[model samples]
Target: MKRSELLTRIVITIFSLGVVALPLALWAQTPLIHARIAEGGGWNPDVIQAKVGEPLYLKFTSDDVMHGFAVGQMDMQPVDIEPGKVSETTLTFNKPGIYTFFCTRWCGLNHWRMRGTLEVTGSETNPPEPASPPLYVTLDLNLDAPHLAEVVPTEKASARRGAELLRQLNNLPTYQSPDYYRLRSSVQVFQDLSGSGLTDSQRWDVVAGIWQSNTTPEGFAEGKELYAQNCAACHGEFGGGDGVFADDLAAAGTASMQTMNGDMAMSMQTPANFSDPQRMLGASPALLQGKILRGGMGTGMPMWGSIFTHEQIWNLIAYMYSFQFDYPR
Candidate 1:
């Protein structure tokens, strides 16, 4: 062939190779992440590198049973990952930070352990403002301390009665405020009401009113749904500590009596009984919020700081108080 013909053939061959190679390069950029139970190694490629304000494509598949894919602190619906099938989602982050991703479904006893992280890097045009400390932290509470109510109401407190009573009282304690309710327990509120001339039972009713006023019926329903999905396995449906894992937890505690600090290990202890008036009533909404957000230290309670929003955490706290008081339907 002539030199010109040979040059034309070389150019055509190079163009064909580039067309095939471009697609392969793009495919290589997106990785397939695998999901399995914690025992089976949890999420494969658990650490993902991403860029801020750029679309990140994640492909997922379950190695065993069905699993869910969700990023913490994100406002996206979870995608299901069925065994032998692939599920994918594309996300773009506005800020740069380390974000956690985890399974949304209750896969097993160790479901909470299935968590991973995404590291996003980029420049921010408008940096986020600093957040204030949580109320429990600001109050400097010892979350592990046993807080028992000094006075237990003879009858269940009624929110409907309290609302009527609230309208009649001219002077009221600051207990009605969200900040007050969050920081002070129902028992504390009852103590504060001693000067109000209301009977002990009436004081309890007023406390119930305060709780009811802070939350809505819709919020309670949402909280109940969240508890059933996330907490019922370890804390019974009725807020009793007789869940299916209670016995196993007790056994675990018996097996490991002491921890590294020579203190009794809370991990082996059964979950807290929300129905216990003394314990539940003594815990303020802020205290409960702290516990739910931070999780129990070495108590087998997983930290949900990343999983739930601040409003959702508050709603859960309000529902917890429902086990102690009777709110109007």
Candidate 2:
């Protein structure tokens, strides 16, 4: 081969190698975030800063166990970061606000604690309208107070049975209104139906039918999935409050109390038992919505207002009521 031709071929090979290496060099400069259990420092440099309308590149690697990364209230697929392996994601925001990013995988009892903040700064092109307060806030609900049902049903109510009886009843009262149903407890509705000449059991069945009517099959499926992914760890798969993390939560509370003295010690209570007829029947959908959005006062329940959308919360509330009422599947 001629010397000039050989020299030109060598230069071409060198240029090809530089093109490949340049991208890796830039990627290496991107910040590498580390993930671990909440007990093990959670996310290092948990707070991130970026400007709106600019792509934010992120790199993640798990320090201890497998972990999944996702931003709350944002539409993005979760990226799993296996132990000692790296995963990457890109994000862009159009609005300026504090967004939450959390670990999707349940690592331990404090898995929900594995949350970080992303602060985006820029002017909004189309600002959102001011929001109205939730119904619980508007009605001044005291969530911590006991809400007990005055009347308990002798048997589990069925929505299917109620539908049959409802067709025969002449006067369909105002209690059947969806507006009234959202704000009042089941017991209240049952009592309101007394003037209709129906038996106590029939009244209970009517309430079940009303509750089932408020939700659709699609919404039910969505709620079930949300509960399984987010609430099952602490609230149990069936909402009996005997989940895998329930004992750990109680133990953590006890340990916290032991380390302190007097009322300053946190009083973390057991997760709510949705299967309890009395407990659930006494609560309104609005009240439950507040609890979900604001979380428990000291019950180790994390606030999900930022994580779940309004519709998602309502769907979850409807699905929870299914535990108390026997609805036609």
Candidate 3:
């Protein structure tokens, strides 16, 4: 062959190879993140950097038991990370913010502590506006305060009976408002109904009906599933604060109390007992929502603000109140 022709053939071959090799190089560069229980150091290299509108590839594997990987405030479902195997996912962020990535599985008592930050940086055509403060914050609620109800119902408040009573009452539009339901506790509602000439038991039933009206069957189901998946390990299936890790948490708290160094000591309080009518009834939906969003501050509860959406958080709060009221399943 002529020298020119030979050179042309070599150039074509090199171009073909470059096209194929580039993708492989990029794929190989995707980092592998290790997942382990919080006791075992949680996620390795927890802070990940990414660009908005760019695809970020990640590979994950568990060092101990099975765990789940998910990004908060994103619409994707969690990908399971199994021991001795790898799970891969590619995510593209549209907005620029510090997003949280966490384990969805209840791996251990510190499962909620298994969290990391994903720093997504880039300019957006329409940047998101700042969010207003949550209702609890706006209301200046002291979430740590003991908010036990002063009055206890004679019997389990029945939503069906309450619904019947609501039909007889007039000029009580506030009782039907979602805002009222979100801010006022059942005890407050019971007190409000005192002038309606209803017995304390009847007032309790009315409160239950009001709660049922604010939520739907679908919302309850979603809340139930979320609670079982994320909360049942520490809060119990029956809302009695006797979950698998309840005793472990109590023991951890006791051990911390004995430590002389306050800063180093952990606050491992027992999970809230939802079965306690006074406590649950006294807590407004907004209070419960705030607690779920912010988590228990140093109380062994993990912050869920990034993990769950606003509607999902409200749904969870509705289901929580169900433990006190006899709402239809």
Candidate 4:
């Protein structure tokens, strides 16, 4: 052959070789499709569709027990899966069709059914777009009518005061989990105040009747002492709303002095004005008792009916009535 023709022939051969290697280069550059073997015996998805020539990458996990992940009839190692653990693999599917995978290990009776399929199509490319936001909703069955009721005392006496204390606790805010966690300190304080030996019911009785009338001045003094011992931290000694726990209670959105500002409009909620003569003066003993038993609705007032005995509630009422005598504006 001529020298020029030989050179031209070599150039043509080089160009042809480049054309032949181009497809292989493109194939090596294909993106991989990654998937997981999630716990619960089921793949996160039982079916996956991929375009031919795309690389397949598999990720799997077993949240409960050990299981095997085999794809397209290919034998895989008996990977010991554990709870909260995961495994993965990569395989390229050159052909288009339905490919199935199953667990090879004896993962229990349902191991046979612990299988899934992947569909491969050549024409389509790109995954489908997500249609909507993954919105989560919950039905709160516990948030219906308040779990409290009001009761009226038949007479105006110290027991009504006891009933009011019950109302205070009953109307306590619906504590969040965090709030309850924070209450640990308050619980300790309360336990120290009433002593731990008392049952929940007894402690409530002490708190309710600690402030009421007494057959003697000494009895009344004893009641006041008890109030200081068991109730002063939250209700204040004079019931003027200053309490050791008031700030913490308010921070946790519990009712407190700051919440019971004089102007009902500035108050966190409409607080019961104990000094209001029209509201308090005309109230019959029965009405006052009822108010103590059943706290005002939608406020932090709670039902004290179950917390104090009827007699205890009456004594507390008399003590509260004494507030009128001492602090009548």
| Candidate 1 whole-model C-alpha lDDT, 0 to 1 | 0.86
Candidate 3 stretches with Cα past 4 Å from truth are: 1-19, 261-266
lDDT of 4 at 77: 49
For candidate 4, write residues 1-329 as lDDT tens digits: 99999999999999998898886576455432222333343655677666788767655656556666666333344444455665556566665667676555555422434656778888535655554321111212222122221222223323354444546655322321322312222223224335436455444332223322222355445446534643455456666455555554455343443555533422223334443323333333344456445553434343444334444454554544454333111
Residue clash pairs of candidate 1: 253-268
Tell how far residue 309 is off in model 4, in angstroms: 1.4
lDDT of 3 by residue, 243-318 (tens): 9999999998877877835565337799999999999999999898888888887788778999888999988888
Q: Given candidate 4, what's the lDDT at residue 197?
A: 60
Q: What is the lDDT of residue 277 in candidate 4?
A: 28
Q: List, residue by residue over 1-329, the lDDT tens digit for candidate 1.
A: 99999999999999999999986687677778999999899999999999999888888999998999999879898999999998988899998988999998778777889999999999877988897888879999888899998888987899988988887894565667787788888898889888988988898899899888889889999898888878888889988987777777777676677544446646557889999999988888888888888998777777898788898889888888888889888
Q: What C-alpha lDDT does candidate 4 achieve relative to the native structure? A: 0.46
Give the candidates in order of lDDT, highest first.
Answer: 3, 2, 1, 4
Model 2 misplaced regions, further than 4 Å: 1-25, 168-178
- Tell me which of candidates 1 and 3 scores higher on lDDT: 3
What ranges in model 1 sit over 4 Å off? 1-28, 258-266
- What's the CA RMSD for each of the models? 4.2, 3.4, 2.6, 26.2
C-alpha TM-scores of all predictions: 0.88, 0.89, 0.92, 0.26
